[model samples]
Target: MALLTPEDLEDLLNKLRQSNETIKASTGKGITEICEEVYGTRPASQKVAIVPITAGNGIIGNFSSSLLAITEYFGLEGYITDHPDITGYHQAVSDGADILLMADDHMFIAHNLKNGKIAANHICTGVIYSEIASRFIHAGSKDVMVIGLGRVGYAGAEHLVKKGFNVYAYDPNTEFMEKAIEELGVNAYDSADHKKFSMVFEATPNANTISEGMITDRCLISTPGIPCALPAELAENGDIDLVMEPLVIGAAAMLYSVF
Candidate 1:
C-alpha cells in the first residue's frame, strides 16, 4: 500500500470513529472534539513546548512540521525547540509552558525523571505499538510477525496475541525473546523466517533490519521505528506494502493519557 496521505488519515480516523463505539464512548467525542478540548481553542496563547532528542541533526525536521500542523489543525499554540537536553526541558518549564513534550529518546528521559533524577514534567509521545496492532487488525491481518522485543514491540505482540492472532516474534536480545515466548506464548522465529508471515510489525530502531530478501511477495509491513526497518527498494517496487503511521497519532495518544 502507498503511504497514507493526510486525506487518507482523515478517512481512517472517520472510519474508526464510526466503528469503534467503545472509543467513542470512552473519549466522549471524536478526534476533533478531543483536540479542541485538550489543546484548547486558542493554542497560541497556551504555549506547549516540544523537545526532540536524537543523535542526528534533522531529527526534528519533519516531526516539527507535523507538530506545527497539529497545532494549526486544532488552533493551538505550540513550537519546537532546537535544544533537546535536560537544560532545555528546565527552560521550558521555567518559562511557564503548559506541556513539555519530548519525542524519540523520551523513554530514557522519562525513566530518569520519574526516579527523581531529572527535574522536568515531561512524557514521551512515542508509544504507538498498541495502536499499530489495532491498525493491523483493522486492515484484516490475523497472522502477524513482530520484529524486536523491546518495550513497544513486546506490548504490540501482547495486544495481537490477546486479540487471538497467530503471533511470531524475533529479537537479537535473547532475554526479550525468551520473556515473550514464556509469558506471551508467542512463536519464536529467526529474523530470516520473516518471509513466512504476510503481515509484519517491525519496532527495531536499526535501519534496514528487514532487507529485500526477507520480504515475501505481497507482504504488509507496519513499522513505527525511526530509521525504518525495511529497505527502500522493496517498499518502492511495491513487492510489499509498507505503512509508517504518522507520529502525531502516538503523540495524541500520549496527550490523551494526560487528560
Candidate 2:
C-alpha cells in the first residue's frame, strides 16, 4: 500500500461525491449502498471517534479530519480526539464512542467497542471493491482477474472465489501468486493470453498496470490502488466503466463493517 499524502486527498468531499455518482452510473448503487450490502450494516445513528496515532511516521496531515468527515458523510455521529496516542483512545472510550478509528504507518483500523468487531482497512477495501466488480458481470461471466496480490489484492481474490467467481490472479511476486492459487483455489492470470474480462479488480500501488490490450469491449474495473493502475487513454474510452477512489470508500467500509 502507498502512503497517502494530504495532497492526494485534497477536496476529499467532492471527490467522494463524484465517486458515488460514478458507482451509481455503473451499478445503480452508491458507495453507501454498496457498503451496506457487503457488510449487512448501516451507518445510521452510530457514534464514532477518530483517534489519531502518532506512531512510526507520526500523524499524517488531514488524516484524522478526513476520517471524521467520512463518518459524518455516512450518517454516523463523529468526533475527533483532542490529544494523540493512548490518551486519545481513553478519551474516546470515556466519551461513549461506539466505534474507534485509528491508524499508524503500518495499519488503519476500525474497532467496534460494543460488538468487539475489528475491521482492517486493507481487507475491507478489497472485499468491497470485489463486491462492486461482481455486480457488473452478471452475464454468466466468471473469469475475474485480480491484479496485485499484496494484502489488499489477496483479500479480494479470496472474496471473489467465495462468491463463485473463477478468480484469476496476477502479482509480480511468484510466491504470493502461488500461495493464492494453493489456498484460495484460484488460477494464474495470463496477460499474454489476451484474455478479456468483464470484471477486473486492480489493487496495485503502481501505475499503468492495465494497458489498452487488456480490456474487452465492455469492462468494469474496481481499483483502490493509489495513482490508479489505468492510464488516462484507456480510462477515457466509452466502453470502460471504472470505480476508483483514494481513501473515503475504504474508510467507510472499515466503519460499516464493524458497526
- Estimate, for each residue in 91-167, the C-alpha lDDT of model 2 and write its tens digit: 99999999999999889999999889999999999998888887784334777889999999999999999999988
Q: lDDT tens digits, residues 115-228, model 1?
A: 222211122222234334334322445667888787668877876787687788889899998999999999887655544665677886677877655545666676667666
All candidates: TM-score: 0.57, 0.96
Best by lDDT: 2
Q: Which candidate is the best by TM-score?
A: 2
Model 1 TM-score, 2 decimals:
0.57
Model 1 misplaced regions, further than 4 Å: 1-47, 51-70, 73-75, 79-98, 103-130, 133-141, 190-195, 211-216, 245-249
- As a whole number from 0 to 100, the lDDT of residue 196 in candidate 2 is 77
